[model samples]
Target: MSGLDDVIAAETSLSEVDGLNGRLVICGYRLEDLAGRTDWENVLNLLGGRMLPESAALRERLGMARQRAFAETRWLDDGIAALSITEGLRALMARLPDGEDQETALLLAAAPSVFVPALIRCKRGMAALPPDPALTHAADMLAMLHGRAPRAEAVAALDTYLVTVSDHGLNASTFAARVVASTRAGYTSAVLAAIGALKGPLHGGAPGPVLDMLDAVGSPEKAGRWIGEALTRGERLMGFGHRIYRVRDPRADALKAALARLGAAGDVDRERLALAEAVEREALAQLKVKKPDRPLQTNVEFFTALLLEALGFPREAFTGVFAAGRVSGWLAHAHEQIEGGRLIRPQSRYVGPKAA
Candidate 1:
């Protein structure tokens, strides 16, 4: 029962994470097929059980939802600005009215994209920009954050990241969303619960630290020495392993390829990318030698850090950005749980003292 290993909590058709085979299928499409070739709105539509062409309508709805979230949460003053990015998002999301419909889902999904950038600006003493409904979801988010239109390559990279992390089979945050939804509490409440779970270090928070590790290693030549020392100290390497993936994480490859594309467009630091690749090789070799029995290869967070940093997101806001992408899956899972029409309560055995 520890860590609920192999527990079948709920059946879902949204996305499947095949850890053994290093494959990810989202709504019947392989992740590699969707990551760069499609937009995040299309992925959202697919998760919602709609056709790919319906992305146009979903894009417009999401745009309007962003506008509403921006207008209603205009109270992002010094009080809210004092909080961390993720905390600020949670505070704003708490203001959304309770509901379980698609409209509610759209609002919940849009809140992070609006609030994360706005919070980033607020922290820096700048005004928040409004969403441009005409642009794609990823482009608009980048435009709002940077106060201008982003390059096409940047948008594509961001969209790929969103699609890549949109959903994994019953991750901690998605499960939290489902558990809250099983009570029929509303999509907003469920999404809020998911964000809380994602804020934890073991879940959606590792991407930021991955950058820190890279900075500490400093260069490819030092990578082996730094990694060896760190392993000697028994510190867990950020972005290196996953609870499910025994082989290399497929999402890591997807994002790495995205990073390479961004570099090709002259948007990313090629030297940094090269250093990261060298470090990855060193880390994998070290892991293999240190723990021969364990198959600890690279996971999604490895390239996620490099890609998002290239896209100009601050490290502290990484998890909030992750929530923005993942809210789609959370909402979809919430709807699925509501349809099942059962409470998610589980029984636990007594391990403490028993009463007479």
Candidate 2:
């Protein structure tokens, strides 16, 4: 099978990615129904069932975990100056104490928020700020990055981003997390493994490049000509395709909605957003003309770039921001996989030789 196409690797209650119909159902709720209505605390409650703390307690516990994770930021060494944000983050996660307890899981989830902004500050020669245990996860993260308390609307926008990407089906990084969990490894190791997988360009790295594409296009009038020339040279459009979804990605819509609201509130450039909307329409029309049989509609990367940019994150730090949201799902998946008590050892078909 090419890239394990149509293979059922494991059963999960985390989230469902319906590629045919372009719907994402997390736990028992539709993504559209759950994403904007709730925050990460409630999402974790749903995914963890009885394995995690209650929503109120989980918030308090995660706040403490974020403070605990501050100690791990000392691993942001001189060598980290040469590494990407995600690389620095993965290296820091590797140094965390390895364990499978709820403390370990919460720490791993909180570490990304703690480390990502600190590394960015370190790169800029600024002292790393400490987390505010009293703030919400989204608010604390933005405050840490900007060195002040975040605006309420900015916090809301980031909360939506986190909840939207909290979980999906067995994606590359999530599968890596589960495979490590299957070995009965500590949740920290599983989360570390997932971070490594997500660092790849094909997985968690596309959003930043989507920003690059928009920069190249420059204006709405230039979008069609720019995309055409790129396609003629066999360049893959960064945000226009997906691996599974035959229609538009549901996460794309969720994020677009968030951006629209942000734009309406004057938090972002409405003109730039209008240009992106034009690009999306042209890209979809061009994709249809190029590959009629294959649906290459806009995926999550499209709006992820716009939303994160609106949230004031630099393009390079986009993947690290992604890890912050996704670690929640990774911990949940790791815990669930560990309970199965069966190692994920799959058989490989030997087709290289016909010897007996």
Global fold similarity of model 2 (TM-score): 0.97
List RMSD in Å for every model shown: 1.5, 1.3
Model 1, 1-356: lDDT tens digits are 88889999999999999999899999899998998899888888988763112564777888888899998658888889999899898999999988987777788888899899999998998999999988888999999999998999999999999999999999999999999999999999999999999999899888999999999999889999999999999999888988899788999999989999999999988778877988899999999999998889999999999999999999999999999999889988998898889999988978999899
Each prediction's whole-model lDDT (CA) = 0.90, 0.88
- Give the alpha carbon lDDT tens digit for every residue of 136-234 in model 2: 899999999999888888888898899999999999999999999999888988998999999999999989998888888999999899888887888
lDDT of model number 2: 0.88
TM-score of each: 0.97, 0.97
- Runs in model 1 deviating more than 4 A are 50-56
Candidate 2, after superposition: displacement of residue 207 in Å? Answer: 0.6
Clashes of 2: 0
